[model samples]
Structures are given as structure tokens and as C-alpha cells.
Target chain A: MSDSDFSILGGPPSERNDESSGGNRTARDDRDTDADPTPELPPGDAATALHRARLYSLLALGLERPDGNGGLEMDDTTALVNAAAALDRTVEDAATAVDDHLTDTAERKKRWASLFGVEEGHTVSPYELTYLPGPLLTTVRQLADIRGFYHAFGIDVGEKMPYRGDHVCYQLEFLAHLCLRDARLRRAGDDEGVTIVVDARRTFLEAHLGRWFWRFAGEISAHDDGFFAAVADLLAALVEDEIAILDLDPEWVPDTSEVTEWNEGIFGAAGRSCGGCGADATGLEDLEGSPGNPRNPGSQTAQDGLDDR
Target chain B: MPQVHNWQLNREVEFPYEESRPERQWAAMFDLNKCIECQTCTLACKTTWTHEEGQEHMFWNNVETKPYGAHPIGWDKRTLEDMGTMEWDGDTYEGDTIFETEDVDWDDPENHPTEERINEDVAGFMPDIEDDWRYPNLGEDETAGEEMDLDVHFDEDTHPIWFFYLPRICNHCTYAGCAGGCPVQAIYKRPEDGVVLIDREECQAQMVCNETCPYKKAQYNPAETISQKCVGCYPKTEDGRAPQCFETCLGKIRLHGYINTPEEADDSDPMAEPTNPLDFLVHQKEVALPLYPQFGLEPNVYYIPPTTAPVDYLEQLFGPGVEDAFETYRAIGDGEEPALEGLLNLMGSTEWSITAFEVDDGEAVGYYEGDEVGRVPITEPQTERDRVDEVDGEEVYRLDIT
Candidate 1:
């Protein structure tokens, strides 16, 4: 909405307007899609307060992992020791080997190369968001929106990175880095600067990143897999928590049932993006989950279907 | 090879101070059978906690119908595939529990703190930066390009058939995904309560956790540099009242309290009678019933099997077979990190825990098993008229819309 919003989005002024329009579309769609944005709310005032109560209630229902093994092969403590040892070998000591591919690229090398195209060599990994799908590029635009919101609240992503990338996480990291950066300068006696930066941390998180976060995550979750949904869920919880810390009344953290109804009617739940799904997506036909069905012997998942029956 | 976040994966692993105290022990339970899909829990949560800025993506609490549940629809397909175990439901897909990974950049950077600390284990750029939630799952801007049609995204089977509201927030796991996923060790579990949170000063928003979490609970905050996340409203609960969602719940379905133990293990009490439903859900491993327990992150959230979710859903998503596969995987020992099975069991097979609801008094019921926790009771049995009334009007329980 402002000139700064364009800059934070990673583009020139002219491209900014186009992107802003597009971004607005994204926001609008988030509110207008098949998702029941207007989810019914509880019958009470201080609805947000009720929301806060439920959040803590759910957080309490936690689970545990087998120290390292289901312990079938070893006992719980033994599994923990073994797991710790394995972590020393494979993870803690290893370099970024994850359960899934480190990067989504079909060809890690090619992907890495594109990302590390800089003449100075690869500062950024090629497998990073630089290699993701085009739509993913919009992450930059969202970043800009976030930046703009921060700016509106007088918070800057600060100087964590030389340049903001399209990656949303990276951009947020930039903000976190700024927090530490400011803290260091402050400890070095840059008290004034530190104060400004710390203040930015609170405002930026509550105002920009916290607002419309569910809408953003919903977009990712609607079409993506558990990874996206999980990501959305985590983000939703995190932002809400932060908003509470900041003492900012985030509308998304609905307390009243009316607000929930309103929210569902506007954005759908589970961070599920309804912005782009076609209108009237009301039947199994609308959701072609059949192909991904384990029942569909023709699908890749068929062979792995277990005999739960 | 373990994809260790250059920033984190090694901070002086501080034992949560409060968890050591017996009073800090906390837990939860869910009554799937009692749930009518009213979504009051979800709505109450949103309005009370998530309705504000930057939190549009979060649902600290939500209730959905069984089978083809969730907004994204088919959540189980990927869980099954990721876990390497799922059952077919003829033309439809069924639930299949999967394992999740705990890594850096798991949540959105703005949601938690990244490791920008001067020296706490992170070694790059003078400090490590990290985030809590990962993935840009929020709104769009002009820059995201054109609407890439949902068709272009992935499959429609993303939705399952037998829906049940799996209202979720943070599990506050013994081993939190948000805390473990921090590349810079910016996130940490509160010493007193074991609630995982982002250290504002330490977070630099590197996004390592964003990509590392198996559950994808972490997310990205676009242009922000730091990550953020849920804090359990410790400030509020410190007084022992209740969480925001719990307070706002019109149905009074939710309860709030503390968990006293650091480990969610059996504590030599497989059939130990805990105090509340929270205790039941918190000690899931004690019951040998897990919700994608294969993640190995040691989550703290738990759910009872949904009595009405349909047995077929359980078989297809996570039956004993998948559980066996996961158990076997756990048996593989720790030497091999193995690939992350998003929904698979420890043995890299299907694993799931359904939401089960039962009642003690006419109104108070048990939400889950393994622990002596109580949940809200269902007033009436399932009936077409009842369902119609629920759909046409709001009720105490969450009845399926269909």
C-alpha cells in the first residue's frame, strides 16, 4: 500500500504496483474462497479471551517419542543413549541431512547451481527457495507485505541480510538477525539502538507477520501436503502466541464464536488456502483425492497400503 | 547424512527447569465421540487467541469432521505416503499416520526466534539464526505471480472421506519440534513449564527450522528476519486460571491445567490413573497409542480415537499393521537416522491415534485413554434429525456438516 511496501517486496517501483495488486488479490481470495471463513463462534463476549484459553488447553495435550528407539530393540534410556550417539554421527555432526530431500529440486546439483550463480561463489544454496516453483516466488511479495506492515508499525527487517530474498523464512530470519544485531550493539553500549531494534521485534511480529498469517498458511495448506499443513499449523500457533506476548489484539485469534464463524466464512480453517480453489468446490468430484487414494491400486501409494482391516 | 542446521542442533541442552518439578507436569485428552463438529472450540480459539495480526495462519484450536476432513482436504494421503504405510479405501483414501522430522526452520521465522545469539552453538556469521514455523503458508501479494490454479498445486485427493474435527494447536511435546528445529537454537522449552518458545533475543530468522520439521508446524513470515511461536500464554496460566481458548469455549469442552512430568513415558504406569484428560493426552507413549508418533520429535499433544470416524478410516490411515511397521523402524536403533516418514510409524510404516470420547458423569466424559482424564459428554446419540439440527443451528458438540 505504500512505497516502502514495494521495496520490501524485492522489486522496483513499477513492478511494485503490479505485485501489490496481485498481493491484494491473494489477500482477498484468502477471505473469499470455498473455505468456511465465517466459522461459527462461541456464545460469549471477550471471544478472544476464550480463544486464548483454548490455545493453552491444546498445548497441554503433548506426546513423547521413543528416546531413540520404540525401544523394542533397546530400553527407553538405552534408546535415548543410542539416539544421542547416532545424532552425534548422523545429525549433530553431519551437515544438514534431513529425513526428506534437503531441497525440493529434482536435480540437486542443477538446483544448487542456479541458486549459487553469483560470481563470488555460492553464498546461498541452489536448493533453497530460489529453485522452488514460480508461485512460490510470491513469497517475496508476501515478505514485502510483511515488511510494509512492519514499516507501518515502524519496525524494519533491519540489516540481517544484505538483500531480502523471496524466501519468507529468510526474511523473518533477517528480522531475528536484526534483533541479535541490535542486542550486540546495545551490549557494546548502543543502548538507544538496541531499544529501537527490540521494539521493532515486538511490533513487527505482531503487526505484520502475525496479521493474516493464517490466510497465508491456509493458501499453502490448501494445495500442499502435510509439510505445508504442518507448517501452517505451526506458524498459526507461533504467531498467535507472539501476538499475545506483544499485547496486540490480533483479529485472527478469535475469542467469540461469531468471530470464528466470521473467520471460517472468510478464510476457512487449518490455514487451508481457499483463495485459488474454484468456486462451489462442494463434492468428491471437486476434490480429486481419489488418485492419491490408497484404494486406487493404480496410484503410487497403492502398493504401500497397509492391511489395517 | 543428517541435514543439521549449521546454526543449531547443538546448544547446551538445558533440561526444562519447571518440568522437573512435580507440579509442572501437564497433559490433555480429547473425546472424539463427544465432538459434534460444532467448531465452537475452533471459533472460540480464533476469536480469543488468533484473530489478531500476523496470526491469520494459526488455529490454536479447531474442530473438523471425520473422514474427508480438514480445509486442505486429503491430509492422510501424504501422511501415508510419507510414512510408507497407508490403506486404500476403494475409490477414496484413508488415514495413514506418518512420521515427522524435527529440523531447523520448521516454523515461520516470525513465529519464533532464530539463532542470532553471539555464542550459543551457532557458528555462522557470528551467530546462528533460525525460525519456528517454516513455509510461506499465508496470504498472497502481487509478487507471488498469477493464481496457479489449485489443480496445478497437487492432487484433489488431498481430502479424505470420514471427517472428524482434529482440533490442534501446539503439542508442547517433551521434545518440541519448534525447539528442536531451530537452526540457531533460538527456540527453547521453558524451563519451568516445558512450553517450547522462541527466544526473542536469540532468533535471527534463518529459517532452518522451517524446512526441518516433519509436521511442518513451522512457517515463514515473508520479509521478517526473526521467527515467532506459541508461548502457552504462560503469563495467563501462571495464575492457574485457564488458556484463552479454554476460557472462550462456549461448549465448555476444553480444560486447562499443568503437567507434572518432564518425560511423557509410562513412568511405570501404563494404566496409571492420571488426574485429567490433559494427562491422558500428554502421556500418549505410555498408552502405546500415538498420533504420528514416528516423527521422533516426542510431541506433547494427544488425541483419543474418534469412535464415529469409521473403523475403515483407522484401517486405511493407521491400523496395527502400520503401527507394527513403525515399531519395527524404532527397533532399527539410532545409528541410522533414516529418511523422515511424515506419517509413518517408527518402523517407517503407517501409524495413527484416533480421537476417542467417553463420559463419566452425564456431562463430564473421558476424552482419551491410558490416563484418567475427563471430557465433555455427548447428550444424545447420532441421529439424522440431530445432525440436521446441528447443521442448521449451533450446538454444544461438533456434529459433521454432512
Candidate 2:
């Protein structure tokens, strides 16, 4: 961490030491007109692009901190809004790929359905279970929220924006209001792919598979030996790739496996620390870097040492 | 969207909103002074709302250590990624946002692979001491999944008792980032009571809210294909009742009540000043305290710091180490002498302490309680972050000035 990263929000730090690069007091001044000057990618490397996209996306979320007046620079804000719009196309494309791959191989599709526990029967669809209210309503409400965004900067989404059914595509169009996601949607609002895939997912989870899934998955894992675990690992890897391409953190993408882990840990907390711990645990005296543990990720050199005296 | 919070107490309105209409518009206050981190609230929520498959990893209610934050790895530290604070351009406020990213795959259960239990070699039995324990398996060897648990459960770390739990739930903020960030419009705040909720019907399981939220409170439900969080128990509060977590709370630290509009802050009612939702939560009512007011999300949960620790320790957490400053923070936390003095002067020079919380001017004032007399300017934000440092091998007391 650099001195630039220092800024107290609320409460005191958990530990304290003397590492003052530049001690400065700043009054709250809320306005983000300046633009980020970081260098862009040199050329076209999809993986690099993907990685940058991921980091930038994480940064976008971080910008929500109260320090900069609860807002972001106009450039960064537009970039993120645009990214959201573009991701919808990826969603549509992925859904389309899965649906298209399903048509030619009935046996494969059937096996895929059976393996994943898809009880809705074999079908070529994008699924609507992923959006909200209804497929059409997802676009409507999302658009409603973005309306404030447009009004803030005097941008327009044209007439097709309002009352549109394709939220993902419309999201791409909404990016046109800024500039980032504008290129992803082919600049149109016509797509039936994701709407279908998400719907089926909703149906299966809410009605059929939602119940006993945890226990079933658990029992299967315990009995898997290794083959099923390998297959599960492959599927997770594929999905992880998809998420990375979308420039998202694992947490950002909703995955049941991760959520389940969180649920168990949270439940076990016994509601401790809900009211805040009052102990002023002293910061252990500044220790130097450890050469003994090659595995230690936190061992920093003197740069890690902050002298308090 | 950039509206600042108002903390003045307003008395005109009543609390424990109505369910049918979701009309409580009430705020909760947590007395940090009384919190013991029993995590009763966390379990209370899990047993009631998120025991299902997909929600297994989510803690709709958690009380993590501040500076160090919950979920999404280092969320508090990540805030620096935005401004020049983290290694951006320079030392100047250039504005930033909790900018929205891709809409989360709200119902994408395939990507989430699970094992019977945690892999001992990966997440490990003791996480705190190991430091790199992968509770969520964030960063680990590719083959870590090869090892699975043969035991009945995982082991819990034993942190020191000095810690405070910031019992958390959905803030149901008036201007909620989760709701605003949802590409599917799945997360929405009830207009009736201002309790934020996930319209599971509208949510497709795209965890956009998960990314966009600075707090990362919006959780994924694996089995249901939806996201869920505290609706402030609007369903219960609307009916003049506290939510299950609050009702079942072993500590009983949560206070559910409504505040009049900030416009009426000057009126006899409480709940004014710090008009923004966050300031309202952190001060005055003295219920919950801001986990890290510096990171913008502007949470509505407030905490009343416990009195068990030294007055100096409490002073540092709030502001100012002077004698009067100590007295002031204590007074507001007392739940008797009106709003805390630190909360009042910190925000503005307003003498009206009721229904208000002051943050900025909470520096030192006079001598007492074995502390130095006279006031000193509150510590700078940079020093606050410096409070925590990783120990290296070598000589002790090296000042880090990167």
C-alpha cells in the first residue's frame, strides 16, 4: 500500500504504526471533472483486454467510496456504464452459443440436461429466469434507473430505449448514451437469447431444483470419488472464463457454489460482532520481513516497515 | 444522487413500518457499547432467510473488523483503487463512483461448483492464524479443489475479544447503490418505508448489485436464481414489528424508529442534520455506526461504541482525544444526553445535538480521564490508515514511507 491510499472514513484503524509519506488534511470537495490518464492497452490481446477490463471493473466499484463526493470522474463513470451495456451482448452470445449447440445433438443436449439436472426438458432457449419482473419488465425498470443517469448528463437513448423488452441489448444501447458498452450490442436492441435461458433457470431453481439442491450436490460430491469432481471442475473453469471475459470479480457474478460457502460461514458466526467489538487490541510492535517463510505472501521488505518512533 | 446525509432527529414520523405497504421509512441504531460480536444476528438471519443452497456463502448479516472489511476480499482497501489514494495520478480529489459493471449472472448456478465441505488443504481448519485460508477459495493452487473435507464441519478462528461486531443488514438506504446498480432492477427500495429489497421476481440472478455495491452486501442465492438482503424486515416493521434478526437479537442492540424529514430537523422531533442516509445512521439515534464512512457507499447502519475500552480508545475511534471530546462521544452514546458531541461539531457547529451526529470537528477539548489537557486537531485520514501495518523481519519500528 502507498501513502496515496491513506484516507480515514469512519472509526480508527485496527492497528497503528508510523509510516507517514505525506500527512495531509483535506476538506471534502465534491466534483470529478478530471479524467484518468493511465495508458491504454498497446494492441489487441483478448486476454490482456479481458484482464484490464476486470481490473477496471473492480476499480469502478471501488469508486463508490464517499471520498470523491460519492461520484466518479465523468470519463470513468461513462466507461463503466458502457461496460455494463456491453456485457449484455456477451450474455446473449453465450446463451445463443449454448442454445445453438443444443439443436444438432439431441443425445448431447439430453445428457447435458440430465447431467446438470435441467428438469425443464430439452429446448433451444436463452432463459428468462435471470432477469426481473418479466423479461420485458427487466428492461423497463433498468431503463427507468438509467433515466436519471441520462438526465444528469443530457444524453439520449432514442425512442427504442423506453418500453423495450431486451434488457441486455438495451443495456448496450444505454451504453451508447455514454461510450463504453456501445460497441458490444451492435448498436441495436433486438435479441431473444438471454431472455429465454434465464427464464428456464428461474423456473427450475424456484420450483424444481431449488429445493434439496444443497444436500443433493453435497451427497453427490461425497460420493463422486474424482470423476464427477473433475467434470464439475471443468464446468466451473469454463464459467470462470466467461466471468473473467466479462471483467467481473467472482463475487460480482452470481454463482451458487460461492454463495453456499458464504451462507455456511455467515450462519456459523453466531451473530457475534453485530454490535461491534470494543477491544482496543494493541498493534503488535513493528516486525521486520520474514525470510524463514517462503510461503508468506504478506512478508514485505523495509517498504513494509512503518516506523512509529 | 450525490445528496449528503442529514442527521438531525425528526419526531414527526413513527417507526416499525407497515408490511403491506412497506411504509416504515425507519432507521436502525446499534449501540456499539453493548455489542459483543456473538453473531446472534448473523445466525438469526441465516436460519430464517438464507439457509438454502445458493445463499450458503452469503452473510446477509456480518460484523467484520473495520479498515479490514468483509467479502469481495479487501473491499475497504479497494476503495483506494478509485482516487489518487491507491496509485492513481496524484494527490487530488478527482471524483469517483461505485460505477456499475456487468449485470451479474443472477441465476447462473453452473459456474458455482461445490464440494461436500471445505478442503482442509485449501480453506484450512484455522483461517485467522494461517492468514491465507481460502474460506471462499479466492486465490489458491489450481488443484486445491482436489482435496475435500472428510470432517463434519470447518473450524472457526478465535480472534481477540477487543473486536467489535458491526451487525449488518441491508441499509435500505434512501438512495441505495445495490438497487441503482441492478441491471435487472432486482434490488429495489420500498417507496413506502425506504427499506431496500431484492424483487426476486424481477432479479434474474445477475449479481450486478454484488459488484456495484461498495459494501458487497447484496448476496447470491445459489438455488433460487435470485439475490437477497435485509429489507429492514419491512414486512415486519410495516406492521409495527422489528424484523426477525432484530427481534431474535441476543444483544437487543438494534433500535427501529422513524425520523422526520431533515426539513423538519429544527422541529422538536429527532432525526435531522446529516440529511444523507449514512450520517443519519451513524449519529444521533446512536444505534449503528459507520463501518468506514470514508468509503462512499454511505451505509445507514449505526453503532453505539461500548464503554468497556479505555476512553482514549473510544476517543480515537470517534474523533479527538481531548477530555471534553471523550465526554461528548460518551454523552451521545449514553442514549440520554441527546446526540454525541463529537457527531455534532464534527459535521457542523450546530449546537442542537438531538437528532444529529457530528463527525468532522470531534477533536480534543480540555484535560481529564488521564489524558492530555486541551484539544488537538483530529488525526489526519492517512494516519488513520497507517494504524495497521504488516510486520516484517529485521529491526523493529521502521517507518514505511512509500
Candidate 3:
């Protein structure tokens, strides 16, 4: 895929300009202000493509609580609302909540902390690896595979981005990046390139995001009914629509219901309780204490003391 | 009822099944001293057989740190407490077998344990969806005694605290508790290899096999509504290959082979016909002992007791031979005794079943199907290492090892 395809931020083929100028041009000089307007894809394809791109961008930005520095300006909020309306009316209320004062930078940060847990026990993890079954601390393979997908397209998680490669925000951002690439490929009439990009996006969706999105969305919906809940609905809907668009075999994808059940067995009410206080514990924090949580000193101590003889 | 001589117990015990002995009983030995709890064996077994949807919590092979680790959470302690403190007079154990311990009669297939037959003192446990279900790492790395300081060396003869990994799998016992407990005779031991398996079609989800098996290896799959356990990787073994766990063991601590029963071997000299490595360890040199032999299950799986763990604890677990086993293991590991050295070498000789083996030139050469397959050295070959500058401002170091 071309570099422009993966760029979520709209830009020209800067690599081509760099090669022509021997990399001596200023950032502004590389701008394609006078470039010709590209032909659009077919109506159905163009609308689906645009909707997917906008949805991904909105979900990516929305999942990460707004940073006070600058994020999701008026135009972005309008775009998100318009995109949500275009996709389905069910998400319209949630779309409007995107611009609510309660979602302001500081308030959103607090909400983020409450929703996606701060350290260990209290929050729902946004990490895809956490939802899978296996021993914790051996999550390298899954994380590496996700990183490989990003690296294959010359994308890297910025040092400033506070999320791991498997985090929902980063995953959504990756999908948005792929959608943007798909749009560029289609516009350029590079059918082969479009096919390759679409296939990659479909694989990513079926394997990673689509596999776990519903369970994650369920968790969010369970906790909230406003902005995030709406975002969750939008996410689930978008994934389903994408699966249909790509003509991917639904049978090949893992059933999210089964995954939800398995996850609940590990992190739900019937699962292991806090060894110290006997309170219901979920996530790694409750099992292994989160730093500075006085309720749990360390789960290792409790485990050690569980001698029946 | 059938009676079989259990050499570990030094007495014949009653078995519920008839005298239908296999042509060659499958046996294995685990060297605790070499295991590092890497979970390679566990993962290998998991990915091979138990990756299905319902088998998520099942670990056919699990390595847990003693005295606080167990896959089913308190499997050993609960069973031990239920059986009560066994009487050991030196090397001889005077204890009731699983059949003799309770009031239930073994001869009658309908005579299974009711709620009343279970001792009230011992906590009744079922592998439920709650605390007991998903605790594979519940007590992992929780060693006995105080945590030693960083300055304390592990090589020291005596340490304040220590823990060792105990890798466990289905023992495929001669008198399996699951087989005896099954009222429908759903759980059976194959006459060919003596590998015990639960017949899915015959199993009615009575969970008697799950409750009766002291080791708790038989797991209930709610989705399938049948209990399952390790099949001893029979498909691989049938083709003269080692099981997945044994083949993938990173520590090379596992040895799998066929062993003759007490009746089949020459009683006057048990080591006379020693062929495979397990025969040398279990029957001849007597370096490995079955786990919890006092339970009178005649478990085919044997263990070379951990050298570092406390003697009293080891004795309680592996019976009176723990000290002797440890001594023999240490001697074999150090290559002090040639016979023991040969046995250790043969343990890692090949991936295929070694029918006959001999120690030659400090290497254990193994033969399968009347042809030599591989040889393993008593000690691994040392690698040569050197560092040199290859170009201006560039340096590279290379070491040759596999």
C-alpha cells in the first residue's frame, strides 16, 4: 500500500515530492495545494468508504479522552454527528453527546479513568489482549502480532500516544488509517492496490477488532448510556457493516458471544474474588494488586496462604 | 476383584478391574530437579489437544510450584486430608488404598460414594465456575518459608526458603480411581497400553470420575457434558513417538517409555531385563518414585524427587524413598555412577520410543525397532566463544551452541 493510503491526516504523496526534491523541501513546500481533484469511487462504494473512515477517526479520538491541548474541534464534532447520522439513526443521540460540555477535556479525562480503569481493578481494560484467555504477563505474541500489522504499513504508535499497540484507541486509529489508505487507492484507480488494502483491512477486522469489538462494546454499554455507549453501538455496527461490505465469511470469525462468556468467567461476578477483602475483583489489578491500592497488599500473599493441609 | 503387586507399596492391592494387563504398560518419569516451570509442556499439551472452546480452563499437563500451587486449586491437600495421614514405617507404607479407605465396596459397580460416604472434615469440592474453576495460577510461585534476600545464593546447601516446579499429568494408574468410581464403567483402561480414558458416549456427566479421582485430573466439560483428562498422547505413542509434552519439554526433564509390570519382570532381579531408560530409573536403579504411592493407585508416572525441597515434605508426598531417590538423582546428575549416568543419557536419546539402549563412551546410544536411532552425551558439549573486531569501529562476538 502507498504511504498516503495509511495517513489518517489528509495529505498528498509527500514521499514522491521528497524523492523529486532530494528531501530538501520545507513541510509547506510539500503541500499539494494546486493538485487536481481526484475522481470518486462508485456512489455506494464512496459513501461506505467515507462513512467507515469518518467512523474510525471519530471512534479513535472519542475513545481517548480529549486532551486539553486541542482535540475534536467544532468541525470534527459536526463531521462525527453527520457521519453517525449517515450510518444509522440509533447512534444519533450518542453522536450529539460527543460535543457535550461533560465531554470537555478535564471531565472527559475523569470519565476515561472511571470507564477504562486507571491502574488495575476498578476499570474496564481497553486492551484486546486482556480479553483473551491465557496466563497474564505472557501477552507478548498477541501484542507483537498487532505491532506487526502496524509496522507492515509504516505506522508506529507515537511516544506521546499513551496507549499500547493493542489498546482500543490505537486499534480504531489503525482501522481509520487503513480506510484512508483504501480511499486513496480507489481514487487513484489502482484496483490491485485497492484489493490489497481492502484484504488487509478485512483480515485485521476479522482477526482482531471485529473478534473483540462486541464484548468491549458490551462492557462500555453496561457502564454508560451517553457518549461512550453510543460510540460502542457505532463501533459494533460499523464492524458488522464492514464484514458485509468485504463479503468476509462470518463463520470464519470467532463468535463474540463465546468470547464474552469466557471473559465473564474470568472477570465476572462468579469469578475469583479479591483475596484480601473478599470483594468481587475483575482484571489483573484485583488478582495482582494495582500499585497504591491499600485494599489489596498483593495477591501473591493470599495465594501463598491458601494451604488446605 | 483383581490383585496386583505394587512394588512401591511393597504389598499387593485390590483393583476393581479384571486382570486385563496391557502388552506393554506406558510409563513416564519427570525429573523435578531439571524443571524450571517454563510451562512449555503445558502450552504444548494445550495447543495440541485442549484448545477447543469448552476446554479453555483445562490443562492436561500443568506445572505448579509446591507447597501452594495446584491446577484445580488444593487438589493435593484436599485428597491428602481426605485420605488422612498415612502410616509409613521406614520404607514400608501401611495405608488403605482409595478402595479400602471409604466404606464403599469396589466389587460392586453400583457401589459408588454417596454424600454420606464422603468425610465431613474434608471440604467437598467440585470444579465449579467460581473460585476453584479458573485458578491455574492461583498459588503460583508461593514458596514455603520466608523470601530469601538477594544476597542469599541458591547454590547454598541450606536455604531459608525454596520452591520447586512439580509438573503433573494423568498418571494412567494400574488401579485408576476414576475407572473404579465410574458406575457405568464409562472410564476404562485400554488393554493394549493401560492408558485410561473416559468414553464420551458412555459418560452420563455423573461427575463421579471427577470427584473420585484424588488427583482431580478428570475435568468436567460443561459444553460437552462429559469428563475428560489427558489421553497420554496415545496417537503419538502408538506410532512410537513421545507425547507432545515430553517432546516439547524445554528442560528435557521428561522420559517416556514402556515398562514391565511387577508380575512380568523377574522378581529375583527386577533390573535383569532393563531395556528402556524408565526401566533403569524405576525398576533397576530405583531412582524415581511414584507421586503419593501410599494412595495405592500404582500410578505409572514416576518422579525423581526435588533435591532442594525439604525432606519431610518430600517424604509425605513421594513416600519414604524421597531421600534415596534424591541421592540417586544427584549421583546420576554428577555422573559419579556409570550405570546412573547411562540412564540419564538415555532419557534424552531420541524423540521415538527407545526399545533398547546401551551406554558407550560416555554416551547413551538408543535403538528402536532393532535399529539405532540416536545417542545423547552424558554431558552436553561445551560451546566455543570468541570476540573479535571485524572492521573499523565494528566488533562482533559469536558463540556456537544449539
Question: Which digits, one per residue and each the tens of the lDDT, describe model 1 over residues B1-402?
Answer: 112111011111221111122224343444343355565655655555444434444555645333333323333343334444333343222322111211222123332333342212211111111111111111111111123555554323222223455555565665554554454555555444566555555666665544344444444443344555555655555544355555554443344544433244333221222233333333333222334443344455544454333343444433333333334334324423111111111110101111222333333332223432333322334545444334457654536643
On the 0 to 100 scale, the lDDT of residue A204 in model 2 is 24
Model 2 — interface RMS deviation?
A: 20.0
TM-score of chain A of each: 0.31, 0.24, 0.62
What DockQ do the predictions score, one after another? Answer: 0.02, 0.02, 0.02
Tell me the tens digit of each residue's lDDT in model 3 across B84-126: 5478777667876666566444444344333323221112245
Model 1 Cα displacement at A15 (Å)?
41
* Weakest ten-residue segment in model 2 chain A by summed lDDT: A281-290
What TM-score does model 2 achieve against the real structure?
0.37
Best by TM-score: 3
How do the residues A1-309 of candidate 2 rate in per-residue lDDT, one tens digit apiece? 111121121111221132452221111111232333333222223333343343233232221222333222335434433443444444334323322332223343334343333375322111212322222312233334444444544555456324332222222222222222222222233123222222322222333223222233343344443323222222233233334443333212123312122223334442222211212112211111111233322221111211110
Candidate 3 ranges beyond 4 A from true positions: A1-309, B1-4, B108-125, B146-158, B266-274, B346-349, B381-402
lDDT of 1 by residue, A184-258 (tens): 554466555555554555555554555456555555455444322333454455456556555776434222112
- Whole-model lDDT, model 1: 0.36
